[model samples]
Target chain A: GIQVEQSPPDLILQEGANSTLRCNFSDSVNNLQWFHQNPWGQLINLFYIPSGTKQNGRLSATTVATERYSLLYISSSQTTDSGVYFCAVNGFSGGYNKLIFGAGTRLAVHP
Target chain B: EPEVTQTPSHQVTQMGQEVILRCVPISNHLYFYWYRQILGQKVEFLVSFYNNEISEKSEIFDDQFSVERPDGSNFTLKIRSTKLEDSAMYFCASRTRRTSNEKLFFGSGTQLSVL
Candidate 1:
């Protein structure tokens, strides 16, 4: 079993501001995903970066598998981005592909 | 794009009653999973189905919980007897491949409210 811990726990940002959320895991992982849980509670997949860095519009994520940590960056944040961000991971052995999610980072963007 | 779709956005049932949550995963995907999130809590993995059999499951998925891919398109989870504690948002997710680093597309989720 792996434990995933998210940083800040919560965050508040103003429109156009940028922020970074982090996730650290206790054991080795073969998969890592970042998700945004909107106000309506829909878990939307943002990134599936097991390693390396990836960008999608204003969102970007980088994972250093060697250190067992990942970082999610939101640039020029918007009100619509206000929600909970989660990081999930899976191991190479047991629990592989079966996700274990972090508590999440509650983000509130004020207009 | 073909995304996961769940039925009955919400479900309400009495304790001791049976309830089935239905999900239509992406047509081309082979792996299906069920995860439950108690309100304001973390998402807990219930089970993972692949090749028409359960590949893994958590302790929470007891005798009361079962999963079936009755048809090629739909995956269903059945709870023999619903309990108040069972009330939560159950999400259905699927991935095109069973390999690591693959993205799992999840549905809006079925909000089960057991009374």
Candidate 2:
């Protein structure tokens, strides 16, 4: 099984600030996704980037498959953004079969 | 915006009882998956189903666990004999394709408590 590691196990930021979260994998992956788990335990897809860069609203992500790493960026964070952010990936061995998730970075945005 | 819907937001069962978790994935999606998260732990993939059969499953999806697409719209995960360790939040997800860039839509998750 491929190993996924996320940095800054916990984070705290004031509203309107910016933050960056990172994920590192142990193998080459063809499928990589970013998810935000809210307090209600709802996992919402944030990005589906295997390579290159993508952005949506105040959230953005970049995956460097060759380097086995990905980055997620949040700008002008709001209270609603407080939750756990997860990075998941499917190793080449699985061929998009199943996703292995990182331990997630818990973020707390305060006003 | 269609979403994956799951039944019984929370379930409580005895350690030796059988429990079934139900889900209704996005109608148009073809790939479905089951993932679980223990308290304060990362979400782990249990199984992936495609074309009415399991495409892939993790080690955690052992003898006690099984998945089925009973009908065209409903998918389920059954634990033959629950254990205290089986208590966790189970999530159902669906995707329109098998490609790497395809995004998965996940349900809110069903919290199972085994006593």
lDDT of 2 at A109: 99
- TM-score each candidate: 0.95, 0.92
User: lDDT by residue for model 2 over A22-98, one digit each (tens)?
Assistant: 99999998889999999988888888898999999999999989899999999999999999999998877754567
Query: Where does candidate 2 stray beyond 4 Å?
Result: none
Q: On a 0 to 1 DockQ scale, where is model 2?
A: 0.63
- The interface root-mean-square deviations, each candidate in sequence, come to 1.7, 1.9
Q: After superposition, how far is residue A24 of candidate 2 from its true place, in Å?
A: 1.4
Writing each residue's lDDT as its tens digit, candidate 2 over B1-115 gives: 6889999899999999999999999989999999999989999889999998888888899999999988799999999999999999999999999864566788989999999
How many residue pairs clash per model? 0, 0
Q: What is the TM-score of chain B alone in each candidate?
A: 0.98, 0.98
**In candidate 1, how many Å is residue B6 off?**
0.7
DockQ values of all predictions: 0.67, 0.63
